[model samples]
Target: MDLPVTVGIDGSESSLAAADWAAREALLRDRPLRVLHALPLMPHLLPARAAGGRPGGDLLHEVEHVLAMRHPDLRMRTEEAHDAAGAALLAAGEDADLLVLGARGSDGFPELRVGSTALLLAARTGCPTVVLPVEPPGPHPRDLVVVGVDARRPAEAALDFAFAAAHRYGLPLRAVHAGSVPRADLGGEAALLAGALEPWKAARPEVEVVADAESGGPGRVLVEASAKARLLVVGRRPAGPAALLGPVVHAVLHHAACPVAVVPGA
Candidate 1:
């Protein structure tokens, strides 16, 4: 059986948007879609009236109905868990081809765009995680799929994913490397970036690869590039139990104009 695309639903507009995006992605990949809801287990039982009129299960049914209406022929399933949202989604992602979540949860503060659960999963999940913002960026005709690379520690996983997405969407692939040096050093940085992408360019001859190196903070450069990108891909360093996301990944996740994909790398 093919691996399914999994998405976490919290009845928030952002999560609904994520579900919609996941549905489209599932269709593109020819895979099944799985919607998962995570609810906290209350220690004490309250009267029916004291509780909300509808149980948490109703959210799942509503989502299922919405998906059916939008994608009648798509194969989909729903699952509910009485566990922490992060833990449940992490477990579900173990057998999934891709995992998606909303940038913010229902209880999230307006100023804090990304919720804790999404951040934790992106940092720890084995599979790729795509975080969709509540208000998606414009769909520009010239939009490309962008990926950020650290030439010193290049990651093949992120480059491969970006190239595949570009090929699938018939778009160009833009590989960006940000340097802290002055503008004069950008040329050498661009060359290093090109060298890092040379192998992938050969492997995916159809994908038009553009290498760019700019002088500025890495996060700022990538976020600016995302203005005209359909999707942004970045790598997460795997440090075992001591793993922590770099500043660039954190900034991109919180501020990128389009959906962000975090791929684990060595």
Candidate 2:
């Protein structure tokens, strides 16, 4: 069977927002939506009740009902996992097309930063993981999808995902490369960035691509662009335990205004 778009739920407002976003994505991809609730294993104590009522089962049902009401045609299912949030989500999303989670949970601070479980899952998940943030509704241009492109260790998976997403949303794709040298010194790097995107551009000629080479840190550049982007796509380096996520991806996850897609890259 085809892998579904899986979302981790914890009854938080941000988590529920993630569920809603996942439903829309599932409809767009013509895939099933799997809502997974991970209950931490208790050796001696019973499970703590979620915001609604009971622990796992009731919360799942409530989310199911909400999703059904919003997306009547979506194919949805719920599952309860007896494990840590990060472990359960990683295991359930092993074969998933995409794994989605809220940037923050109920225990999250008002600063609206990413939680530990979300960070770990994004770094370790086999499939692409999207982190959704809770923001007030406002008017903003949504015609572009921003992607952080690294010429040194470019990730084909991330580029492909960005191109496909831009094509799907009928938006332009902006490939931004950040460097420390002056803009003049970045001419060669800019050319290299364009060359890297040549195949993806040809593949989706319908999507306009703007190649930008700027002087500064990559994290700041991508985060700034994300303010007007429909989605920000970044590549996570496959590294050892200490270096799972590069500085660029880590910074963007914490500061990006829009939804962030972290794609594992070579």
Candidate 3:
């Protein structure tokens, strides 16, 4: 069976917007869409009692209806789990092609850019996880893909995701490295960036690839670049249980202007 594109919802506007984005992505990938809601069941309630009556339960049906009407040919399914949102999504993502979620959930403040669940899922999910901004898309968006590249680690997973997405969307891909590299090492950084992208460029000869290395903090540079990008791809090294999300990936998840995809390092 084909792995579905799974999206986690919590009945918040942010999650619903993610659902809409996921539907379009599913269409692009020709995969089924799975709408999942994890119900935080009450201690006294049975699993079935809180199955489809939670805040997000009704919204699941509504989301299915809207998506079905929008794309009648899209295959879809809805599921509810009596567990924590993060755990449920992590399990779902193991068998999923991609996981999409809102930056924030229903509980955060208006100014919050990302929620706890989104952060955890992005760092640990087996498949590449896309975390959307809490607010909707802007009026004018750039049709380009920006991916963060680290020369030392050379995240092959992130490069694969970025190139594949750019190919599917028929957009340009920009590989960027943001750090305080010594002036003398600029040439080496450039070469590393090119080396990191060489395989992807060959694999995706049709994708337009641009390599850039800037002098600054990774977070600051990537966030600024995201202002005009349709998507930003980053990588997490998954170092043990405590340090899964590195500083750069964490910063981008909370501040990226466009949708952010966090791919686990190989």
Candidate 4:
């Protein structure tokens, strides 16, 4: 069976936005869209509510109706889980093509860039995760996908994702490397950036490629590049026992103006 593009929602405006974005993504990939809502688990002694009265059932129904109306021909489904948010989403996304989420939930603080559940799952989920910004992006659409390239890390997974997305949308792929080298050494930086992207460029010759090397903090540089990009792609090494996300990935997930795709890598 083909894997669906799944999105986790919690009745927040941000989550609703993510659902909308996930619908478009599903349409682009020619896959089904799964809307999931994670509800707090109740004690075993309590009686189970009817399907209609289940917590979050109304929200799920509303989301389904809205997305179905907007995407008339899209195949869609909704799921509600009685479990902690992070665990529920992680499990739901295991068999999915991609997992999309809101930066924060309804209960999150307004000042937070991302919620704990989103942060946890983004670092730990086996599949790639797309986390939308706090507010849905505006109507200014650009035809570019930006991926951050790190010389020290193996970024094959991220490069592959970026290239494929660009090809799918007929957009240009910008491979950005944020090195701390002095401005005078930009020539060397550009050469290294080109070399890093060469394999993927050759793999997808139909997609246009732009190599950019900037002198600054990686996070800041990538976030700046996201301003004109439709999507920003970054690699996250599988989480260790501590489940730590690298600083650069964490920064972009929170601050990038465009939707951020966190692809799992070595």
Candidate 5:
């Protein structure tokens, strides 16, 4: 059985939020919190005295101490690998129920994040991902979790993951149909979105479901809604034949108030 969730911890406030959120989520699910910090073999990051003292990386040790102070109950582990951070995370995520990451890195996103670690995990990981933002969400949210759907089969998988997340946390689900442009007959689109999600909502009657449609573009609307939402879910465009990644995923990933999960195509 999968033990619990794993959070990628660094010396960042956004990463700290991920640790706290992962702790709460793991506790709620009655599972362990695996806090992992991977250090690449970069000797330049060490102090002058310790630079020549140790060949191995010690920055990751600092990460462990920081996370331990915040969450003592969480099981902390360290990995020293020369591989990329995303690959190390995937190795750790193999047995995890969920993987949590910060939206921005320690260096900061000066250019709206050209590439994102959260997006990478979503593209490759088997488990779902949760991305934390720097600030708190807006006062009132239209939905607990908003999922964006398109004219693709992976959209159905995305909806499944979104509903599953809402049900797991006893939150309401919002199905948002965001497309390139409005069709001439947009009346049936709402019904189509509802129809896609109705089966899952029916299976889990305790959770509420709402269908929302936007006539304009997807990226801006998603960013606006994400400002207040607790979580946002979108289908991952991972280099498939029909892989189509709009600007919405990048927008929401860069500025969302809460965590975002991207479900890859099955």
Candidate 6:
């Protein structure tokens, strides 16, 4: 059994956090860490200003050095490619045990891109992925973990990943139902979410489950939950209203104190 974590590093504060988070994950899984600093193929391959003026290769070296100083026992590798960050990481992920990325890049929205390499991988990659958040709170605070669940149904794979993580990390798992309810049906939201998590409850009888129906934004709710947690898990739907990594995800990516696992799928 070889557990491996592939973390994307680009020398940014967020990317550095990602490296640190991934190293801890790797250590926990009893796996070696691979600090992947992908070098874009060439100038045209990436926009002139994509990497903020510094060469991609330079960032890669910096990331490698950063990891070496922190985790001498950890192993790492770097690859250069012309593919998009998500595509490049996805390609390397073919044999990895897990993949990780920053919640969001420097990009802003509606033109801002929330479906970063992490989101793309979680949404499409065939393996488990964790999106390490770069803002508020802090690292693995108390080990409480939360996973966002859609009211319509619980994304099984996403929940499974979350549960496994919780179990492995010895953290309590909380299932969060994030959505808007009709003004008249406010009281029924908790019941609806409880009903939704029925199977998860039955399967993981030992794992603690708590439900939160936030009156405010779901992202804020998740981020708040994250402050006391070690990690947050979210499922990305393919092509529906829920499919998009909207505001909640965007907020969580930037503000979550702990590492966030963005598992893509409805």
Top candidate, metric lDDT: 4
- Two-way lDDT contest, 1 vs 3, winner: 1
> Per-residue error at 70 for model 4, in Å?
0.5
For residues 174-263, write the lDDT of model 1, one tens digit per residue: 999897989988888888888899899999999998888889999999999999988899988763785577899999998998999999
Where is model 1 more than 4 Å wrong at Cα? 43-54, 138-142
The candidate, 2 or 4, that scores higher on TM-score is 4
For candidate 5, what is the TM-score? 0.79
Model 1 has an lDDT value of 0.87
Model 6 stretches astray by more than 4 angstroms = 1-3, 43-69, 72-84, 104-124, 136-143, 182-187, 239-248
Answer with 3 or 5, whichever has the higher TM-score: 3
TM-scores, in order shown? 0.92, 0.93, 0.92, 0.93, 0.79, 0.73
The C-alpha RMSD of each candidate to the native structure, in angstroms, is 2.5, 2.1, 2.8, 2.8, 3.8, 4.8
Q: Which rank order by lDDT, best down to worst?
A: 4, 1, 3, 2, 6, 5
Model 2, which residues run further than 4 Å from truth? 43-54, 136-138
* Steric clash count of candidate 3: 0
Clashing pairs in 2: none
Candidate 3: lDDT over CA atoms? 0.86
- 1 or 3: which has the higher TM-score? 1
Question: Candidate 2, TM-score vs. the true structure?
Answer: 0.93
User: How big is the RMSD of model 2?
Assistant: 2.1
lDDT of 3 by residue, 1-266 (tens): 79999999877889988998999999999999999988775744333423443545566778899999988888999998888889999999999999999999887777778888888888788899999998666666788899999976788888899999999999999889878978677888888788878888888899999899888899989988898899999987764676468888888888888999998876
Model 5 spans > 4 angstroms off: 47-83, 108-116, 140-143, 151-154, 180-184, 237-246
RMSD of 5: 3.8
Residue lDDT tens for model 2, 1-266? 77899999888889999999999999988899999988766733324565334557888998999999999999999998888888899898788999999988766677758888888888888889999866732368767999999876678999999998898888889999887877778898888888888888888889999999888999999988988888999988764576467788889888888999999866
lDDT of candidates 1 onward, in order = 0.87, 0.86, 0.86, 0.88, 0.68, 0.70
Model 4 per-residue lDDT tens digits across residues 1-266? 89999999888899999999999999999999999988776654222432344567778889999998999989999998888889999998789999999999888999999999989988999989999999666666677999999854548989989999998888998888887889999888888778888888788999999888889999999998998899999998877888889999999988899999999986
